[model samples]
Target chain A: MRIVEAGKLALESIWANRLRSFLTLLGVIIGIAAIVATAAVIHGLNRYVAEKLSNLGKGVFVVQRFGIITNRQEFLDAARRNKRLLPADARAIAERVPGAEIVGWEVHATADLERGEHVIRDTDIGGVTPAILEIEPYEVAEGRLLLQHEEDHAAAVAFLGHEVAQRLFPNVDPIGKELRIGGARLTVVGTAAQKGSFLGFSQDNYVKIPFSLHQKLYGTLGSVNISVKAREPARLEETIDEVRAVVRARHHLRPGAPDDFGILTAEGINDLWRNLTQTIFRVALFVVGISLVVGGIVIMNIMLVAVVERTREIGVRKAVGASQRDIVQQFLVEAVLLSCLGGAIGIAIAYAAATLLAANTPLPAEFPPWAPPVAFAVCTAIGVFFGIHPARRAAHLDPIEALRSE
Target chain B: MHAAPAPDEVIRTRGLVRSFAMGSATVHALRGVDLVIRRGEYVAIMGPSGSGKSTLMNLIGCLDTPTAGEYWLEGQPIASLGEAELARIRNREIGFVFQTFNLLPRASALRNVELPLVYAQMPPAERRRRATEALQKVGLGDRLDHRPNELSGGQRQRVSIARALVTNPALLLADEPTGNLDSKTSHEIMLLFEALHREGHTIVVVTHERDIAEHAERVVTIRDGAIASDERQPRPVRP
Candidate 1:
């Protein structure tokens, strides 16, 4: 019965002082909504990229030096930690590896050039053999791809990166245009299709020429990496072992020596992304969790003030036989109800804000399966933790003194 | 329990003293007082402010323990009990009415009346029934749904009386119950107190008005925390 009265009074107080209640809830609302919206966007972007990256094949793997991460230094460090491999290693793996299909040789260099009156300068030029196209996502926009005959001839033909074509030939076709790089004249047979951005730069902003051209122009000492495709992606490990055997024999390495290369898979990239984002989420959780602490403090202070304001009420209840424990429990329950109510409001606000953002803005958001319950649990904890001191003070008050108080 | 004490001394206190420290001075609110109240008796404690009338009412109602005294309440030594035990005695025994008509502002009459029963841990159904009957007894049968703010001064006082009578406790403690009401309403409330006394409910009322004191068969006066007078007119009291 005391609990009932306490609950009634608590609800009435919250209703009467609505502005203050709303203000107190503001902290929670902003914190939860921000986190939800931010999380949703991150999750959406990851899904979008994952779909694009993994669409072509179910389990295709890429083995490279330093892995597929963006930081060039980390790649170099990892490369140095392992031994080096020449293009002959790829040739050996292509001939001896059984489970994987169509291994490729790739080399990359950068340069400036001119042809006739057209000049394309300071470009990202990639050198690759014809087999590289089989393992990579590439399509010709005009003419045709550099064939085996062209590779053997070391033909002076170039594929214009989308950005380079747009810059050099904005209103005209790029095919049949000639450009020069490393003082060598080359004809543009195709142009890369539009690819907006990858890791913050246009993916189409690159040129792919034959590997032999890169060896001659960039010099023999230029760094390079070998890429392999599995004949059966599901049997990737078997092919990896076969490649290692072939490479060890070709390079004449001892059994115990570490190979100079790295094997990177799509799932490894996924793991790296998840680990990296999870740390960011952890930090976001801490920041938002502090808002809950502030919310708890607001609740505690209000409850204490409520206890003081209702001193006469407490006295009357006592005169009628309310026990100390009864009073304590009543107030504690009221505090719980108050904070839980605020928490519920916070969750609703988060959802509404998330929906609003998802509808009108590029910011991506989705409600987590556990977020609402976690929010409620946080509110409950805040209530209980902050309620104790005020409840105890009310319960332990002197009945006689309290009754006589105004 | 002294074999129930002849029904004339439902309450007895000896050497009761209550003092408060106000800055540098010690204010004695009840100074070594001795008193006895009979069952089914109507007693009025009257005095000016700071004359210990309220103090005696507090001690008599078992709201407070005397600094030094022996208090026998329903054959129990309330003065020697701890706060929890004292609370039990207060819950099952005393009904307090204040000058301010201290009804909870947000509670309806029925809820206010059910408060004591709640402390007694009475089942909700029985509590509801008893509270309804108590309100009907106070002539508030139609006002049970009214909160304190919704009721008039007189009606509010009646609701408080109903709250006091709900548990059928050993005694009703009324401290200036009509202090906030007009003269006619005060007279009517006093008549109700007299009727309750006649109906075998022990009552102790505190007032500063001599006319209010006349409604009780016994009148006790206190001055400076000490008993100044005690008188009872036996068999000749006007109903």
Candidate 2:
């Protein structure tokens, strides 16, 4: 018999038992849905991280005491072995490394800002030299950035983030206004541009102060992170090597000894992010694999039952001259149709869910274009893998005996 | 056993033997039966229960292979043919009318009649046309869309006959074709069979009823796994 006829026959029978067919399809639906949803979320996150990291500026790298530590033990080891990065290290790199265009250091702490009757709690505060603005360009939306004379004189000036500016000085202009930071009074020199939140955390809730006054207010015991920009984008690696040598020489390390500081570039950060997402993808795939296997087994069990239930039908078909191959093809087509239907439904559900998530929540989700075709292919393979045995059983049945059955 | 069947012969069997195992002991269902059926002949093979008439019918219908014999249908030897080949031969050479009127219950009479042509790999339009013509020949032209359950017993049998004739095979093999019908319906089905035989189709009807066998031109009786009588008589006309 032709495949089309077989398909029609299979469809008729499946339609005759709608509830049972739906139950049989549930496992495949869930498996495909989970995998597709995971792929969409992971794909979206990957793109988001790439975009965020690109904002770190080209040819710029960071040197810090502890960078990208993953586990508790690694953190402990780094804390014990690494020396604190000081402002003098940044000066040394700026003076000694010809390839280093700008070397800057900054330190961070959490403090409350009070302006008149209003207070913003637990706001991030960063202290940096005037040159840090050249390395990490913070956009000035109002007033002007702090001048070189401000840092040289240890000036009591502050740069407020967009959120802090909006909340602390809502009724009046923020520039030249006085705000108290941890018992010290400072004038707001500028307000930074509005940078949106990342993963639901506000990025624009911070204040910047000159390095010298930050030392007087918060003390110099805390380690600072150094940022360096290469004079030329193409010479970034050479500039990093030169700075590493200068810093290591100042610390008096042996020629073959490892540097205690961590240097991170945008590429390194991207690689780390990729590794994390890949691990997540692998775990999701494992879970999806189990679901698919269970789904396939359910399909196989139901197909076996269908074979037994249709034994007399098989006999009638054979008596009318249906070949063994025809019978096998009929049943196999039915199984594939069932699974492919499940896959299609699953993909639709996953797409809707991803769209909903992207629209309503901070979690990133992008439904990949390749998911549907690949999902259908997987479903077809699963159907064939699980459907062959039952189809063959139906084909090999003795027609006389089958017809004899009630 | 090695002889080739004549061109006019629809079926020829030589020393056909079939045996089955009942527990540890083997029971011979057909023991060295020889038979020949010609084109356009109407014959009945009748016997009491367990006398092996059904087994002989199964063998003749190509539903079972003989254990130790040679059989030919339409000049082709088929006793040793494989399952696939047997299926093809059955599709192309023989039509079956069952006592139960084995029409697929969900299908209309037209679809059921189209089944044999479907396996024959005929295209859809031609299959539909031929199936319709066969149904009209069986006097069911207006009942083309009726399902088996909606039809009376004789009408269901007529649908089966339409399905059987749609293939236009070399032989029509019926296993107790009127067993489930009342006397009046059985007479109608037997009359249709007579008309089909007159239209030059070879037919073999297997039954234990002497009244049903009397309608045929020839009757073969089975007693103990072998033919007991092969006799020809005048065709009976219904009053």
Candidate 3:
């Protein structure tokens, strides 16, 4: 039989038994919906993580004593063995790596700052050189950034972040104001503009001061973190290798020995994010796999019942000269049409659910454009897999016996 | 077994044997039967219950394969044909009208008539046109959109006849065509059959009723899985 005719017949039968058709579609609907919604959530989170990682700076890399620790045992082991990064290590990298643009180092502590009647507790107080601004590139909203001569003299000068400026000197110019930091008074020279937040932690809550003064006040409390900016993004790998060689040489490390310190870059964070999303996607696929099996089984069961119920119709069709292939094609089309209908509905529901999640919750969701077409293809595959046996049964019916059934 | 049938012969069977397994016992339904039917002849096969007339009809209609026989349809050896080829023969060479007026309950009369053409893979417009013409020929042009249940018994039977005739088959095979209808409706259906036969259509009606069989130009009676009598009538009874 022609495909158009088979489609028409299939539609007529489905319309004739609407309730049974709907029941058969339920499993497929839920299966596809779960897949689409999970994909959207995962895609959204991947985009969110990418955006956050990008803010860590383009081609910017950080070299630390212990690195961004991901495991407890490894972190403790690294802390026990690795030497703390010193100001000399930063200077060595700046001199050796020709591809490096600006090499900056920083050490921070939680110190209370008091200005007139306002006292902000546990404010981020950091020691940095003038080059830190070029590495991190924080926009100065007021006054000017610190001068290199200030760090040379260990001058009592500071730069306030946007949050600290608002907290300690609200409604007044923060620049040129004296703020007491850890019993040392420093004049604020500039206010860094807002840098927003990362995963709910405010990035604009720190204060910057000269490295020499930090050493005099804190007295070697925490290890320093070195920030390096490559001349160009393409030169990042070459600059990192040069820096690694210089730092290792400065520490008198032997050849073929592992570096005591750790190197981190935005690419590492991207790799970690990729691994996390891959795990999530796998779990989602497993769930969808189970649902598809259940859905396929349901469809097979219902199609078997349909074949039995329509035995006489099958007989009539055979009597009218319908070949086995014709009968098979007809039933297959019905099953595929049923599955595709469910898939379309599921995709629509998933889109709506994703939209709702992105709008109403902190969870980010991105509905991929390719999702609907891929879902439809999977639905067709499921139908073909489950529909064949029943269709063959209908096709191979003995016309005389089938007609005699009822 | 006899030799192959002539080209002009629409159906021929020789030494046809069909057996059934009822548990351990093999019952012979058609034991060593020979039959022949020519084109443009209205014939009826009559028998009592368990006389194997239905089995013979099934073999003749290509609905069943004989266990042991040489059967031919239009000079082609049907016993050697595959299921798909047999279906093609049924579609192109035979039209079946059931006693139950087995029109699809949900489809309108017009759609029911279009069934065979649909399997033939004709385009939609052509199938519709042919089905409409067949229905009009069966005097059911005015009831094109009416479903089976909405039509009277005679009308339903007429719709079945329309469905059968739409394919313009070489033979019109009816299985006790009036068995489910009342006497008046049965007479009307028989009259329609007579009209079709007068138009030079080769028709076969299987029945146990003598009155029904008397309308055919020839009658063959079966008993104990064999032909008991075969006779020709000069003047068949009018409906």
The candidate maximizing DockQ is: 3
Model 3's CAPRI class is high
- At residue A349, candidate 1 shows an lDDT of 74
Candidate 2 docking quality: incorrect, acceptable, medium or high: medium
The candidate scoring highest on lDDT is 2
TM-score of 2: 0.94
Over 4 Å off in model 2, which ranges? A95-99, A134-137, A231-239
In order of appearance, the predictions have TM-scores of 0.78, 0.94, 0.93
Give model 3's TM-score versus the native structure: 0.93
RMSD of 1: 5.1
- Which CAPRI category fits model 1? medium
lDDT string for model 1 (A183-227, tens) is 787888888667666545567777788888777788766445666
Candidate with maximal TM-score:
2
Tens digits of per-residue lDDT for model 3 on B68-175?
988988888888899889999999988999988877888999999999998888898999999999999989899999999999988998998998899899889999
Arranged by DockQ, best first: 3, 2, 1
Evaluated on CA atoms against the true complex, candidate 3 attains a DockQ of: 0.85
Ranking by lDDT: 2, 3, 1
